[model samples]
Target: MANDTGREAVKTVPETAGEDQQVQERIRKQIASELNLPQAKVKTTVTLLDEGNTIPFIARYRKEMTGELDENELRSIEERLQYLRSLEDRKKEVLRLIDEQGKLTADLKASIEKAGKLQEVEDLYRPYRQKRKTRASVAKERGLEPLAGWILSQPRRGSVLEEAAKYVNAAKEVPTAEDAVQGAMDILAESIADDPKVRAWVRRHTQDHGIVVTAAKNKEQESVYEMYYEYSEPVKRLPPHRTLAINRGEREDVLKVNLDVPADKIHEFIARQYIRGDSAAKETLQAVIADAYKRLIAPAVEREVRGLLTEQAEEHAIRIFAENLRNLLLQPPVKGKVALGVDPAYRTGCKLAVVDETGKLLEIAVTYPTPPNNKVAEAKAKFRQLIDKYRVELIVIGNGTASRETEQFVADLLKELGRPELQYIIVSEAGASVYSASKLAQGEFPDLDVAERSAISIARRMQDPLAELVKIDPKSIGVGQYQHDVTQKRLEESLGAVVESAVNHVGVDLNTASPSLLGYVAGVNGTIAKNIVAYREENGKFTDRKQLLKVPRLGAKAYEQCVGFLRISGGKNPLDGTPIHPESYGVVDSLFQELRLEREQLGTAQLKARLQEQQPEELAPQLGVGVPTLRDILDSLQRPGRDPREELPPPIFRTDVLKLEDLAPGMELHGTVRNVIDFGAFVDIGIKNDGLVHISQLSDRYVKHPMDVVSVGDTVTVWVLGVDEKKGRVSLTMKKP
Candidate 1:
């Protein structure tokens, strides 16, 4: 029976062994089709996933078994596999519930089995789904169900009134034939509404042709949702951004939203399906159809349509967030430089931190260069002292409050110092405060205040974005659109996957990585990560990857999954720094012998050239490994200890900051993409406010999404389209036109 939750609490029937195999086969086929991968490959990947291998580990180490599916594809397979398994369980439960009712039919069972989505299964079982007291239930209780069935059959010989008259009984509360007919019609109305095929057809028609209309609650009030106040768009054509905007507006009580469905078309379609003849009861049946649609079907269809739209929008938002986070995390680290980090403020004074080439804090200070207390000379003197003392090569300024004034101050200070070689970059200080106040930050810097810790974070982020950014929450990074609006659980999972993928792709330095960074490694949880760090601190730098097995709570399984992604430079084994796993050491040794090279010469240019000359297919036979593995080994040999992010463009550095007023239409400038959303991208062009490049201006041709053209940390050339000085907003266009 249906509970308050509106779902039937069915007793689960365990699937037979054969049924389980069928379910697995069905899932494999679905995943293969969805991912455009071979069925065999999907089967292998699923087996690896079921065996507890992480996506990164499977993608990197088990390429031969899984046909070389990348991390993204493997993630997709995993998500779909989980959904399919849940779908199968629900299908079994639904089938069992229907069978127990003694009402399950061959056609109905077939329909349930063929159902692709949970909604379809629910619709097929809607007739038997227990519900609260309704008009239909009241008619059934009044003994009018027989008359309702007669009316539905629409026999040519009998008069509908005569059949309905026989159902009238005083004891049953049917006082007259008219009352009996009305009661019967109520039951028939609900039956028509409950028909699975009828509901599916109506849902599909409405979703294809319906229009979503939104109007402001108060026309006079201005809001961020003003554009959606009088909007009407086809449901099929509505973009994810507009749907999310409309949903947000409705949630905020600023807009009234409704669906404009084709009621007349829906009525005609139902008539053709349920109406059997031009009998005397045709008018009565037509009235019942209208009632059923308006009272039962239309409202439910509208809700389903809205839910589908919301699910799509949420998925899109999550995908965008994940992509932006990946790009932001993979931003090229500025290595081998001493930087002075500034956390700008007005009343509190700007907090300063100086770090050497390795991001170790050398000094901390405070200066008032902006607002009520503009101690320009004092700030300049302090900056000169720090730069000279630490031999600082770059200034890393947090793009937060009072950043413009701070930039002006730094530019002036640089001129006085005559440091032409020194440049400054405006790094996104998003979540810097959150990280500063975190317990991890306090543990790292017990003597530093929040602002001082934030200053150090900014400096370190510029030096190594991935290492520092992982310490904070991905949601707080500010690279997403509608992040707070999406399902928090799903958003966190997706973003976490992105972080894991990025960390594994760029193997972590075992000696230097913090627990937060290590926690993202494959097979390493927070506890294990902390234990690894503790062990490292107690034992000094790890001399080999094998030592991870000795760390408490880190056993053979954890070491197997994580060792390949953890790099130990100048370790006992030269191959440890590369992605080559410990199990593959024999293959590497054989390859070195074949090439007449020593293990110490592995990363040399000479060895790389020699490895490049050998074909992977030919070498695989000799190495007794798959061609994919051999190719990967060759790649690692060619570029040992290489950072994948170094291939991307570096962040833009500025000697001077530009004011919003400085921008002119058609003026071209190079900018770094700060954040990308569905509608547009925000580009940092050395200005106080980042400029917006709408999706239309993203390219000379049509753009489907901003991410398709650019990603966070990408450098692109854009021309100023317009500037709003009053609002401190700048419009930019990547296209020449």
Candidate 2:
């Protein structure tokens, strides 16, 4: 394996070409090109991280070395490397299995060596591979394979039954030739099943054209699985929701599900592969394979194809969920105002809390604004007194238990007071209960009840989503689809990336950011996060981002990635409060120099206008940076001291609450979609049970997936299709009635 210079040689290592080794090699070459190394020098043995390359580091610092490989491409390279290595290990294991069976023929060995993909290699290894006791073994035990073949030959118009009967002697323990041929047919069935080419072909055909057919095992069986009692659809075309539902139905034993490929098509395909044209033996061979299809191969292949489809759907769901969660979490915060929080309930009344501009609790109370349970007039009075007493400018309502009724009650009070300036939001209270029971919640609110603590947290969430939301686990936020099913580590990694991206996108205010939010910033982990909080306690508020450099272990690289996303409001320099990374300060300065403008002289509104007028070609050359980067810097300089997440969108405020019975099919109604997985979108539609819009029912055009059209927080227009009050399930569709 040594090369001309004594290094490892670049070996082609012939593989069974399933997807294409060239695609993989192209990716490797791309990686090598990015690293500024020859393809030969970058061996497969090298680890990306051990070679001093981080994802961000390789993406940002080694741009010239990576041929400007972006984050997405780098991640793809990392994934493909793992898959290729796994394929190699699998190949070795397969070869070992065949060799140990002592059936490794020269032809078989040649086929395996020449194979360019895993599928092909596995195919060639199939016949010789060890397996459990089968019908083929029993036929061999009876010593009747040749007899079966002779009957198949039908010599001189002989009767097959008579010929088979002669072979079935008392010594063999077969009662008759019919029985002997049955055993022979079993052997042929096993042979057909073991054929690698047939297996590979069947797999491809099933994936490409198979349909999932479901039927009620017993039509009279009464259970919660009525909708899917008898349902069937093409595998590729089945929506994510129905797939999950059908799977659940099968698990619960109410339905029988099978992968349905046209039997005729498979028979024809197999006939082409195994049977010769117009021969006497052809009929016998066809009969054996037909028996195999019914008794052996069909079930096995069906299971394999079904499993593959499920895996593909699950992966698609995980990807969509991650993206939707990112957007929802990164939404702009409505900051710098006192907020009144309300945790709405009917039996206990609405629990309320008032927090100061910085989200420190100032008061708590229980109030009822409208009801047959409590006097509407009295409840309204109590609520008004609290709002006036606390001077609350905004209200935060938890979108939970009686939220719409409470919003209406509060809206009525606001209208009576003539305060149009006051606004309220219905925030998702996903992990509020979990947080309420946690040690952190207890430590923060030792004197307040759990409900009151929840109310206070809701208020703070509006003030700073990044800080407040980080206290709860990302998975608990309810924005993900099949969040529980994905590989736990991958889920956590993807969700963590989303949180970090969101936090960084809307830069944290260093002076006010909590340890949880700080920990997510680039280069700041839990220990450093705690240290920053401690340092701030000892040294007062941070006036500028430069003060971060003095914090222990806060290095230049970390500072560079994080500073732009960490803002300082009311600072001397306006740029400190914007997403203009400190490393690009020189570029901003040069832009100002060309315009004869001083740093302090720039105002956000005018500066943005001016930058737009000054072409990228005119400004980028002067700054000595790429036009893309220069344009971004100019845009940031214009809005020097701005909070990226300005105001949270107004939460759904309804005048009245309606039950599921109140909704009619074809009624156009507004509702929030709580979760979106691979198959379909789940819309709350203000009902007790959320209704599913199967992926097929999602749009007018062909939708490859539900995620392409909708996301978790999206407020959608849905037409109520049907309602099952007993099951507490509503059926809604995005399509117009």
Candidate 3:
């Protein structure tokens, strides 16, 4: 029943609280089931997130509240929760808009309310969305809507043309019966095209049956995308990487891509859905159905299909990049070593910086070890003098221009110097240049040149990878597949999360952390991090955790969120240095009283043994804390100021370098995983170019993804599968004979 006023009454959510709660409960249950989490975990986690708790805080400190959900799991719930909530908001808006037009039926409202996917909801609302000067709108303006409806009824009594003749008015642009009939058909075609059920069916059918076909614009052109020059794959079988590759090629005008589907099937489905028995309007309606599918429906569905595929590909690519970045950032730190850093170059001469154990810039030197200036003897004498005088323990080389030659020089020098402890490592200086020219770097070292800053960065990075790497943009770290091809906002958000998780995991040193590392701590933004640094400089070092409150704009709430992750060694309270929150000091004191242990005994071997012997499951109730939290506290007390990265294996430092010509098929060598991608892992085997371990060769067993076998910073033994000296290609395999 249409309202005369052309509007229907709508209930505000405040008036529908009970119904709103029911919808929320459904959303909670759906998210829990979809994520394979306990319903209680979902409920508790959502509540914590809603209260503005950061993921790192919840994941690290509130383990009991979230059932010990890790950062990744918590983030997944957060994403899905946001999507479901946004979907709810969109559903309400759609219902209100449809009601404003007085067309909100019970069935339509129910269908829209029950829709799970955003696409499904959009499909249902497509019919009610206002049109923008379409052929159908033009036909309706010409007053042929009634004739279109009559034609849709498909009555056996009257002819379509005869019925259309009555609406033939020249003033409205309907010149004759044929013109009116054509206009009526246009209206019918658009209506059929907009039907939600028809679009939904066609979308699913095309996705399941369509073929992604691509052909080169110039068949003989040579490019990196040659594999996709003449490619055809079933839509369901296409991988994310290949989809992005073909899309990039098509964008660059190197390829023509199309989604191929059977047009006849769509026309047939439209016929069976909107038409009934053999009747008078069947002839006119049949042509309209074909026109609708061919003109309106097919192109639209193709775009939707392509868009969905692209969205999925981009999401997967971002996830992979995030994972790789996490692994790279968490590479174990090489602590307490005086390092000599070399930013390798030719004509500019290798820029050198010496950093003390505390990462202070000690000295800067430039030596031409590589050609354009073959001052090898002079370079060796200067390096030897520096090493002896400063007692430098490690040589860190940037894996950039002239790196191989630099490595060779350092190797020969170390051999001549006869220092068994002096070894060098090649680190990916991926974003070192970006950091060197950054404002943060400029403020940090005002007098230093960009190359000097880069050398210092490389040195500090090898000593403490997490601390130094956090200073650069995660995207510039370059452990990504098609990173530039995906949406940048999303990529930055994901990589930032990864960096945040890594920073909080290690728990930055309050006095020593740079502004870059401090910025990523939970609840601390860029401005607050800088203010804290400013406060520290004006005052002395923070003696206790409470001093954080004195920093500008760092309120009680921010302190509560960030304090647990900020450790102050040699603070007023010994517990301040541990991971245990100050709020739990009562439980710690009680535990100490029960165990008869002194606070000074923290980090002692006796304390570790005692803490390890006591069962957390048994002591949790007595301690008045949850088991997870109590266990964490015990571990923290046992090793105050613990760095999580300390537990992992350290990077390999080679005393000698190998040449690409030295590699042969079946030769065995160990390498560090520089980057992991969808197709394979790039292994740095002490050569100019890193070698590739293809996904199929990563293991002898069946592997679905390369990440399943290896990750960035992994040290594994790889056998040379082949070597191309002219092309500078080294193909390696993890599988051994």
lDDT, residue 362, candidate 1: 92
* Per-residue alpha-carbon lDDT of candidate 1 for residues 56-90, written as tens digits (9 for 90 to 100): 88899999999888888888888888787788889
How far residue 354's Cα lies from its native spot in candidate 3, in Å, is: 0.7
Off by over 4 Å in 2: 1-24, 29-85, 92-188, 217-224, 277-284, 368-382, 439-449, 480-494, 522-564, 568-577, 582-614, 618-623, 641-644, 647-737
Off by over 4 Å in 1: 1-19, 157-165, 169-171
Give lDDT tens digits, candidate 2, residues 508-588: 788888777877765566666777788899998888789988887666655655566677877867777776767777777
* Cα deviation of 47, candidate 3, in Å: 1.1
The alpha-carbon deviation from the true structure for residue 471 of candidate 1, after best TM-score superposition, in angstroms, is 1.2
Off by over 4 Å in 3: 1-19
Residue 133, candidate 3: how far off, in angstroms? Answer: 0.6
Candidate 1 vs candidate 2: the TM-score winner is 1
Candidate 2 residue 487 C-alpha distance from true site, Å: 5.9
Error of 3 at 538 (Å): 1.5
